[model samples]
Target chain A: MRVSLSTLRILVLLGVFIATVLFFASQIDGYMNARLFNRISGSVAVIALIAVGQAFVVLTRNIDLSIGSVVGCTAYFTGGILMAWPDLPPVLVPVLAMAIGAAFGAFNGFLVARFRLPSIIVTLATLAIFRSILVQSSDGSSITTDRLPAWLTEFATMNAFTVGDLQVRWIVVISLLVVLTAHVFLTRFRAGRTFYAIGSNPDAAAFAGLNAARTIFLAFVISGALAGLAGFLFLSRFGNITVVAGLGLELKSVGAVVVGGVNIFGGSGNVLGVLIGAALIDLIDTSLVRWALVSEFWREAVLGLLILLAVAADTVLMRRLLRRKGGAA
Target chain B: MTWMRSWEGFLFLVLVLIYALNAWTSPVFLTVGNQINMVQLSVEKIIVALVMTFVIINGEIDLSVASVMGLAACAFGWMVQAGVPGGWAIVIALGIGLACGAFNALFIVGFGIPSLVVTLATMIAFRGFARVLVEDRGISGFPDWFNALGQRGLVGPVPLAIIMFAVLAVLAFLILQRTAFGRKVYFIGANRAVAEYSGLDVRSVKIRIFIASGTVSALAGIMFAARVGAIRGDIAQGFELDIITMVLLGGVSIFGGAGTMSGTILAILIVLALRNGMALQNITGHIQTGVLGVLLILSVMVPIIRETGSRLLARVR
Candidate 1:
């Protein structure tokens, strides 16, 4: 008599996506422009990069609150390196950035894996510590470039291709790649499904001898490394890095991960959902500015509302499914 | 008793040592005036940390405390400006805090979600609400009586707010040490289902801890307003992390089942002393934050290293 819970959850989210798109569509009387698209997509790319990495951690039922700091550390180091050697290749920056991030991520995983400490606490301690290092290292000065290598900024804009009078940025292309790769890794790869299995039931996964430590450690490394890649792009796009740069990102990325329907308790949710969640959050920011009727102070309120609505929807969906299954029983 | 069992005593010794060091190094540090100032500044956050001890000990977190404090401060100040009696305003202020914590608990308990993500969302969401409530501007001009909160002291230079915080801390220490509810809290935090099977009223205990945390935060909110006599959306900036650092450094396990208020108070003093010492030494604010970060990592590392060392000894023995 009613829609199944999983389907209903998707349908509700799709409905929200559609409704927001339509509402925004109504405002598309040429006011929607390239600069706006660039700004929104730019913001989405940074958050997506972190969220995708966080997705890996969350898949293992562990979380890394240090992603924002990882981004900061990597970006600052990237800036320092590139500024000293401006002529050095663009590809090299990403490589260094990823390595630094992976080292930290591996440390996180090691603490959880070797010491068997909780990921939340270990990451929490590192979050402040890393941010502190960034603050001290910079001494409040931003690491910036007067100009980036051409390829560095290429990800920000697409290949001048037109689709129905709208141009998607190259970052959008990257976003698709990131999301696709994430989806495949989670769904198809041996390591990917292992993450789901571990998160779903850690004890059983351990009993199955899946090397929970390696899987979790790798997840954190991927999360941290990807955060580094994101950091490189962040510097390239924003052209600035300071003490507060990438500040408050961990929470926002967590918000994105949580909103995307990845259970905080872990075990469920997909990257596709998170990608959509990321876009929706971006759209919300744009739409709020577009509406112009309400006070701008409502930004946090609306975000809180979205988180609540998602949790509420999740509860209702779960209850409905439980009721159906129990009734059959 | 095991060390963890008598952690309170060990913690008190550390507190004494810290105070002694402060007294020895800075001639002005132990002076009644400076001590009062230290107490006045740290009370609100200390109170919040006090209740947070219970929440975290119960295997939950309330990241919304800062936001609740922000919203409460905004509401309390705005109401007083609108001609609400200060006493009645205090009541409403506490109510707003309870409401905010309860709102967070709504999803936490109602949806069986982890408090971390829920509170983080609300941290943004509620801070956003506060921002909207008082759009980027701070409100001031409280009655002169409000200023009395910061200036007045009872019994030879102990600020009233500090005195009040001390009283609350002592009462909390007693309750946590001497009450069935306290034991139940530990039980539930250590293991929820077992406590439930023991008929310990886990839900009510949880809801009550949240209320206590909310009320403590609200009290701090008002006291902060009284102390500073100002209301702004951004008051207590980055305070949530600071309090958590104090709590964790105080030796409260994030996973719950262990921790003491005495340790929390000691940790707060260590942090306050560090901050005060850093400030007196002319360190910048950024550095102060960095020091706290350093302290957080070091305190965590020390115990870990201690355990590792002892374990190695045991194996060799």
Candidate 2:
């Protein structure tokens, strides 16, 4: 059987994930417990959402460095709104958050698509601008758990069902559904495939009658909306929102996207791989705290190392694979 | 000269208007002391910005520069605390910076990875290393002379940092505008394949530029440590924002192969003046950052807007 390159990448990634979990299980006492699964899965849900969003942007050969800021902004704003109106419908709150996030993402997309500016530079500016807006608006205040509605705060740990000491939370299920939906959309829909077409070759895509600019714009919008959704999840999970709430998550999401076998340069990858990547990263990050030998300060360094290694390994493996295929042809 | 009608010229006019406005608004804005103080505060970023101009112009970026600065500063602090001589500590800290740069170059050039991804990872890793070295503790109380080099004005009201900036600015201009190596940077950035076919050692040029960025960033880090008279794990964190802002605002193309050192210097002045003016008016740091972010976006957008407007006009004609 001949597996496609992306499928092979995902398979290799799954193998690595299992190997890593097994390695950690042996290294740490009681590492294979249900509590570990619950903690890691809950955290992975937040990161996985953002990583999926980042994958959309990266798919179109653009990036949204401002996603972290968008997450922070939406989370804080959503928290503020919920605190003001505790009786508001739960569905409306996430909609409002997604609306706010989409607005910010539209601004980024407009600048990049309309002006044909480099997405990296534009998003980099928006990143600071969005954070600064949060800082200015928040006025040195934070949204604490005490002010949040009980339902929202309790939703974080509310389990959907338990399977032999392992409890599956609602947020995890929502995240998984999102990943699967995005996966189907990207593979099965014509419009969704435009992202890959444009990313793989913008000129050729344009020549083939595709609206590259519009696709790029849509990618950012999706990224922003998803990030906003993640922000809502973030608020529910933590129940505390600060101006720095989503700081450093931009890098983390990018780490997940790249490590999940998505080409950083764009045109390849899937959300399912990103979900596994998020789980792998959060697993290491949470596990490192209990590993004893690695200090807390070393976590960010390990994340960086993992990204570099992932990129290097992808390049080497792909090259070897391509060469072998060329020889056969 | 046609240069007077270019973007830098327009920036010069804006600079003058800002200076006038600042002078009008604040009583002490025009004073030599205030002017020197303004430059003193951001001298390190501007210095690093000088090298960053080269990196951007060469079609690459070093996001790791700020983290490299943090690492160098923290390493120096740790070594001093470990009883290493201050002088030796400075040397070793700089060596660490060079190593960090070489590490970036190795992956970027050797492994064929994009500079953005490589530097992003290193940015985190380098800052991580800094945090590990200092571990939330503030290191201070350096030898008196070492502090004096950063704090005191060696040339009568002009501190050593200012003097260094001046010398480096001139050298950067001369090297960029007048040297064959400068030409190679532009050629490689403009079209790497063509440059290679034309027999330029594109790899060597890129490697050298990154190494220079690392070294300059380290020097800036050391200067930061000296000026603040303290060191911590988060030293120079987010400084890349301002440094890159300066370079990009100066009209350096993010895509590489175009820009001038003179534009960057003017941008440095404009940014420093803007920040200083805002501080004089008691604007908070975050709000000021917000303004710079706006400027950063506008700087990139305005030119494209102009070009498109002109094209539309031509079409109508």
Candidate 3:
């Protein structure tokens, strides 16, 4: 009958998310509809993938600030490849995008794992480096919808199934699969457990015979690959690929990971929470645009406030819970 | 041998080489006007970087510095547009900066939250506030005197900003190297638990450092407004990372407690020189930023690489 602290946190988050949605639904006329779900769900899919990747990195006690730039790089390159080889198989495009993303991730991993460089600094540098590479490669041109294949554009809205007025797209299904797969791996597998072990206490993990460096490196690689998959989804969702694509996604992904009840200090959190976190953020964002009282300028402010409150609440609640538990023990 | 072994010494040699390379490529590379122009263009970021060195060395970060800069500048512009006197607007902008810093300090010191997460939130919030104040609008047409403070030289061939930079750099060096407060900063950074155990007022010191970071960032924003003769929400949008890069490249340990003002000054100069040299050679700005990113990485890695190489050599011997 005992529930874990993480489980309690997740339940609280879910409650908050539902309450907010209800509040928005009551205020905005005609807010409870399939169109709103379709819009928020589509964008949530992209944010969820990156957030899941970021969750992996956070679980390893590190961060990948370059994921945004990695998304931009992979998205642009994938678009260019599809444009060049229009007759190529549709299945290979995402694979190619993931490969490109993995390469960028490997570069980050090498510096952080091999040199013991700080993850924040290393990824911060690579964020610029990767974006600059994209800028130089793109050379002022952008890949518009006209240049991309019809199948790719169609894939964005292609429905997996429908129930009444609600429709589920393939991208949403893909992102959910990725999240569920990551959730299982982190919870059920030993190799995946190493990430939490390293993050919680690196010195202890080392003493326990874990290869801390390799695990950290693997975390970065997985983050990179997920970002790449998100990039492919991005290209499909938005047929235009600009150099500035995915520019501020790093902030959004980090925000989602933290707001999802995942410990920012790294170690205890689940990808299911991240999925909810991403949904909550995207829901707020889309709702704000429709709300007449709040200006669009307040969107970033709201996101910032949410992150601050989430972190603060997590700290306060956890302290009280732990104190009570300590007394019982 | 000792000088060669030092990070600053190695940076000085790199600075000299870049100077030589620039001088050979562009005839105007060594001119006083071009040199002053180079310093003027980045004076705001360098000023903030000086304070940022303190923040980082104190074992924390202020990701919101750039956002504070933007907010301060926009606040000043908003006030001026509403017919506030030029002098009072400047003071209010700085006050706003102080408030911003105190806000960051409250979350970090009072709540015991991590500085990184707190500042990251503020970074977004502050920028959003700036955007709200001046949504897609650029405010300009400041008083001539204010513009002169940034655009015209106060001393012959030197503007007011450069003067402020010089004074602040000296003050920073003296305080960091010669004062007891500076020692406390290092001690706290090296090990906060030990410093607290030793009876140092860790919370007060941290609060002061963050407040200083906020106030300095605001001052830089004011300077930016004066220099550009305009203000917008996106002013200094991505300058935080660039400023941090300069400090980290100066050999300041990101983990805190170990860095010198002299190293930071050298790094500022090296970055300025590198950018100027590349600009003179007609390289694109993006490419220049990319090069600096590489430099940021190499700066941290070089010491480690050198240590490993030496270890390998010793093993062979």
Query: Which candidate model has the greater lDDT, 1 or 3?
Result: 3
Question: Candidate 3, residues B198-284: lDDT per residue as tens digits?
Answer: 999999999999999999999999999999999998999978778988998888888889888998999999999889988888889
1 or 3: which has the higher DockQ? 3
**What would the TM-score be for candidate 2 when compared with the true structure?**
0.98
Model 3 gets an lDDT of: 0.91
DockQ-superior candidate, 1 or 2: 2
Error of 3 at B277 (Å): 1.1
DockQ of each: 0.57, 0.78, 0.74
Models ranked on DockQ: 2, 3, 1
Question: What TM-score fits each model?
Answer: 0.92, 0.98, 0.98
Model 2 per-residue lDDT tens digits across residues B43-139: 8899999999889999998899999999999999999999999999999999999999999999999998999989999999899899888888999
iRMSD, per candidate, in listed order = 2.4, 0.9, 1.2
- DockQ, Cα level, model 3: 0.74
Model 3 lDDT tens row, A70-145: 9999999999998899999999899999989888998999899988998888988899899999999999899999
lDDT by residue (A63-120, candidate 1, tens digit) is 8989988998888888887777779876677789889889878878887777667677
